[model samples]
Target: MRKTIIGLDLDRESSQISYYSERSMEPETVSIQENQDRYLIPTPSDLFTLIEGKVELGQMTLANFLKTCIGYIGPSVKPENVCIMITMKEITLAWADALRNACQMIGIPGEAVFLQTHRESFCCYTLNQKKELWIHRVALFEYEDTKISSYIMDIDYHTKPALVRAETGKSINLGRQGARSQEQWNEQRDARFLEMIEEVFQNDTFSAVFLIGDSFDKTWAVESLQYLWSNRRRRVYQGRNLYTKGACYAAMQRMDIGKRLDDFLYQSEDLVEHNLSMQMEHRGKQSTHMLINAGTNWFEAEYTCEFILDDTDEVVIYARSMMGGEAESYSIVLKNLPERPKRTTRLQMRLKFISQGRCKVTIRDLGFGEFYPASGKVWESVLEV
Candidate 1:
């Protein structure tokens, strides 16, 4: 069945959404509420009110309420070379869940909805070009309310021309860091800021830099702007709509609604870049089965299989990480299994990741059939890779 793909961008001040439909030639960015800017939606502090002590969050204007009420749920993620599974706050999932409900109210399937953080959206925005984005590494400098942060995204060539290695910086409060006057602030902050930039450039290379946040718009008031492009190219932008549009493009790519994105594989904390497989004896020959495949979202990686224990209750699983490094093997023991005739004991195994460092494994005994009957026994395990 055709999927109703939509990109949902959730932010603090206001939340924006972009969508792609086959009926339209291009993606559309519209306000979540009526009578609002086509690309802007309001977000209030109190989205729900208690009428007689019962909160009515299921109103038709729920999207409208989210526009003015929801705070930032998901934080920014930098695309890195590491294949790690990152968990989100329960509050963040609540935002995505609510948005999916909103999509259902509008005749869209909840399964088709996707969430993108503003930072990941920025990567989607710049990586769409044929060779431009891959040709040159890009950096993002954000200037918000009272802090400054940065992200470095570069092309990784470890294995073919595959993905981007991202590095995110800790944000520093500019208001507390600056002096009394703008000029004095620059005079005091230029050296420190320049040192930070120099340290990064000393270790890496960048073809272009993106200056975001409202602070960049007021370069006239800040003198540190001069060093933004001492030897490289720079792009200055100030707004919130860019993320929504990028998210729209992301949705299209996810559903293959438009041109496919082939070259830019983002290896962020949210992306899993490893696969776990086991080599076992099937009949008289050896066979391999993947418990979890690389390039799949960790949250979505789950599988169950029933196999007969060969000669040992111990099983060895091999993994290849996104780092494109050597293959590592992990051994798991079933601990307790009823002794039976060779190849007559049936065992059910399940694989799932509870975190980047932990993959939960569960094994249960199903016996061999009516002849062998059931054991009503189970064993839980943790496979650390």
Candidate 2:
């Protein structure tokens, strides 16, 4: 059976809901009333007429009209198929409790509720070394017949920094001060960001990770996260699949919310494993070599290589892929190596691949004229090479 997924973007002042229908491959938006007391509620029109000098209804008299509109729309929807999206700030213990009461009143099951928060950070800052305002955001999701769920909650304290001194006088320093000599303050801010991330992870078993925000530089946040997860050694929690993208574009592409959710949740494990194994093999094959795979499909285009011999005796590799016609790459360099007195040399390599099509990559060690393909899934070839 086809399922309906609803994506709700809720803000402090208003809310928007989008519903994706699989059969029609279309989305529909439902109108929501601003005030709660306008529709279906009883009001003595005679009393209002008496209060008003004119025969026409006044602005205050519209309260009952709005209530009637809500009442008419509320009964038409099936609570079981509804999914609610709300911001993290919108959700509170009280709101959850109130939602539960509302569900009970409507004969809807609380368990059917699902929540999601948008991952985008909306706050901004300047470059004058001044503190700005703190903006908090939360997004919640729920099915029509269930309780509310929060998808993402993010809080950002914005600040403007003094622009870096440059020959061109370009404003280089922007946004909040991420790292300072005062390590205590840095730690406090980092902890808050991590807490927000952990809250989303705790809410559901996320199949993908979407990084969203408006800041020009996210290196600090990403680095802090790397440090946070670097020491985590448990395999059960170690293997996580993440897909990062911008929030606005993701929303635009996710016309079918149900399909998007399903796709994110059930990505292929085999593909991930194959890519990782391919990287290990290529790194083990050569001291300094460049391997490029070019194709027409996302699964086919990939490039990876390593520079093993440098003055620093470090392994450097770059990899990238052209998935969906977008080229993305990453490079890593490692330093220091052992000499061959005991033939004990530490080997490391980095590789990057960008693909526009599906292609198989094979790495061969070329000793002047001879070539040998590294074989094995476990990456033992590093010691041999």
Candidate 3:
């Protein structure tokens, strides 16, 4: 059976979905309307004007729409082999769990449903692009509801998974339909707006900038567009489907199939898309062991490994970053044993990815035979690299 995956870009204002299939060979944005030729579907509470006392099944609403999204996407989900990914601005744990449950009912593996913040989709989209685009810093300007958010995609060749960090959500009052709508308005406000944008971009250099939002048209942002075009380092791309396409890229990354990663890992405030592993020696021989695999959603990245303490009390784990740079090695200290012989103390080491910034490491001592009962002592450490 062909693999099917859905990537959902959700926010309170609007939501979009991009679906990929083994047969299609490319990702395409899904249209929610019955007859309209559009990709994004508005979920405003007031959009339900067509129906009266009877609420329509497919009627989109802020409340019921998000809750039933999993079931709504169920038809696109393949039985036994499928994946569902949701990228949102913010979601409660309860809603995420509900999504997981809905996935389970449709035969999708509980672990296959990936949840991440929206900026992560931005990082994934940019990082997955050809490395040539990363010559300098990459940027994205999102204009929504009279507000502008500027996100700078930071690239660090040093870090592994979270190499791409987004610095964004900078807002200013380019108010709705004010001076921008007036064709013969005074040049004073326009000049100040241009100056404000120049100040924002004065200190930074961007290789590529993606302009997104309904207000991005020529009519509304003539001066701002002129400023962006004149001062930009390279090309400035515009579109409403970038995030949804980026989400699709993320979903494909999980399938371990069509998506190609030249050397891209999407990492954000609460998401870690890279695996953490370690190289160790066993019985006078050297071997590699994987602790956490990449492409795993950070919320579900908790894993435990129990092993008896070796001759040394120190354990070292390396985050094998793709491409260049030395692997990041984190040495975990397993201290305060029962003062017994080597290999007598059994230690259970657990690595839990707490946030994009760090991973929490917990090491507990589980004893060997009857003579050395489990001591119940533990050592905790944080891997912030």
The global C-alpha lDDT for each of the candidates, from Candidate 1 onward, is 0.59, 0.30, 0.67
lDDT of 3 by residue, 122-208 (tens): 877776677666667877877778666677787777755336677764557655445453754424335544665676567777678
Query: Ten consecutive residues with minimal summed lDDT in candidate 3?
Result: 50-59
Candidate that would win on lDDT: 3
Candidate 2 lDDT by residue in tens digits, 85-172: 2222223333333333444444434443333223221111001002221112222222121112223323322312211110110111
Superposed model 2: Cα runs more than 4 Å off: 1-5, 32-75, 80-90, 120-257, 260-385
* Alpha-carbon runs more than 4 Å astray in model 3: 21-24, 44-76, 91-98, 130-133, 157-162, 175-193, 231-233, 271-297, 304-385
In terms of TM-score, the best-performing candidate is 1
**Clash pairs (backbone) in predicted model 3:** none
Name the better of 1 and 3 by lDDT.
3
The TM-score obtained by model 3 is 0.64
lDDT over C-alpha atoms for residue 207 of model 2: 26
What TM-score, computed on C-alpha atoms, does each candidate reach?
0.67, 0.24, 0.64
Look at candidate 3 and tell me the lDDT of residue 339. Answer: 82
Sequence-dependent TM-score of model 2: 0.24
